[model samples]
Target: MPFYTYMLHCSDGSYYTGHTDDLEQRISQHHAGNLGGYTKSRRPVRLVWSQEFGERYEALRAERQIKGWSRAKKEALIDRRWDELSRLARSQSQFTLRQAQGERVSIVADAFEAMQSAAQTAHPREACGLLLGEGDCITAALKTRNVHPSPETHFEIDPQALIDAYRSEREGGLRVMGYFHSHPTGSPSPSETDKAMAAHDGKIWAIVADDDVMFWADDKDGFHALSYDVGSG
Candidate 1:
């Protein structure tokens, strides 16, 4: 039997994270208020997310790690927004780089060209990819398979590809600066779903629309338009 890490949306609009060996029974306990702890007072809780792990320790570790996340990051995990989660894992000091950089993003010229070409090639369907580099300078835009069922309306990078990227980063590879996606028929701006899925970490989001590419910063306040330069960066 697998252990599980779960998150609950409490009636008070707060979130609770925990681990358990019996997901069904544990959720039942929370619903019945039998635990007599956080969920007791915050009754009428709803299970918003859960992930199964092969080991108890893994589940427990995930629970502890998630407990420390901000509400936005937690929601990003629940939504499986891999790009947002990637940057959200950065330390607080790293996030400060966005402020220190004067609200600007820098990208290599070829990377910009590649992203535009990808958008044009994937026309009528959404093209998605990972932005890789250090700090605010994007050196590459590595295209990933769009695994969303409705590719024309939405985009979801293959989770396995994202997992591989993170693993590579852990082994001293390029940093996961942010992500890129095309809006086949819309403006090069975040859509409603983008806003809802934002991690609120200080990461960049490049949107391609109508052959135009624009960059935005994901800040806690909301998405902010960012000026960018294309060159050696």
Candidate 2:
């Protein structure tokens, strides 16, 4: 039986590499997001590269090797540019490092301004909202009423607004990709309450503190700071 090493392009514009004996079934699991771990949340992953091996060990070794490669090297492999691969390998030590601020995720300028504006006026109190867009991009911000009892600190988005946004997504409107909230007196980093309350359901959270707004990816492991562009469109 042949084993395979495969690569998937995740929705966040990152890559996932794996080894499997059944390529078709493994990819199906990834698509279903049933495979879990890194690929679980970065769904709609599409298989971009795969190579069959006579033995499982060979496939495993290749998978391990590819996992350590830079994105450029991986893309070269996908495009089958062997010469470029060698050049990329050599360049890694000096110049091929992944950009510190990744361009994978994006939020529209209007959405960002809306969030900032809402938070500014709500100073001394918290502001909350929902992010609507498609596939790792936030195109709109739906400012929702904060219903938390202690408005100066905690914030809870109005439940009915959440329900309505979800209903709209079902009807082919913008997707509810994530949520946002303000940290009236501190940094945009997640607080203890956020860690405890957020579901870690693979949603992005935009946190605003003062004039600075930052993006975070909430996952089972923890909150990960994700660099994002505020696109103008």
Candidate 3:
């Protein structure tokens, strides 16, 4: 079919739903600075859920229904946990794990460099990657591409690559610490969409960059800059 619907799990962990005719091409536009709106400033969005339909009206109806769902309900949809969705529907509140503490400068710089290299290679749009590290020491950098960019930008990391890297790291006792992405023509600051997408847990550190870089830890104040060399412990 000519119609497609997609769900985006923003940095804040919230869900954004939309429909398009050209699934892959529409997502590219979102990341290429072509579609500028709510997701414009939120440059790097991840596709957590998607489905195809034969009709545009059906896709739109689905999107509207999903938009009104509770957070837990939305997450269940993203995770495809249909069973738990009903239980979550009865709960009044939700809780998420806390993100880990902030990291050191050396690690952040290493991540920035990796993202910069990706950007250069993918020029005109943007490049993305993940940094696997211990408490604060970067152990490995896994590079990926923004393969789908439309109603929003979605990343694609090689599963085998990530699995191999993770297994190797765990064998040595390290951890998959944080993630980083580049914005082709935007600022590093987290936009409203970023805040909405952010996971409450402090484990995920979102590093956004244009020409410059800004890193934000999960906190009530939202994303703030981590001075290039002032290591936060």
The residue-level lDDT of candidate 3 at 178 comes to 56
In model 3, the worst 10-residue window by lDDT is 92-101
- After superposition, the stretches of candidate 1 with alpha carbons farther than 4 Å from their true spots are 1-101
How far residue 56's Cα lies from its native spot in candidate 1, in Å, is 61
Candidate 2, RMSD to the unseen true structure = 15.6
Query: Relative to the true structure, how large is the alpha-carbon lDDT of every model?
Result: 0.81, 0.81, 0.58
Candidate 2 residues lying further than 4 Å off, grouped into runs, are: 1-103
lDDT of 3 by residue, 1-233 (tens): 67987977544333456789998988887767587744555557777788898998888767655553555677887788978886775542221112233533334333443554565455556555666766655544567645544313434455665677678767885576656665655566566655686665554454444334555566566654442331111
Whole-model alpha-carbon lDDT for candidate 1: 0.81
Per residue, candidate 2 scores C-alpha lDDT tens digits across 76-128 of 99999999998877775443244334534677666876786677667779999
Q: In model 1, where is the ten-residue run with the lowest total lDDT?
A: 91-100
| TM-score of candidate 1 relative to the true fold | 0.56
Off by over 4 Å in 3: 1-104, 108-111, 147-166, 204-208, 219-221, 230-233
Candidate 1 — which pairs collide? none
Best by TM-score: 2
Worst 10 residues of 2 by lDDT: 94-103
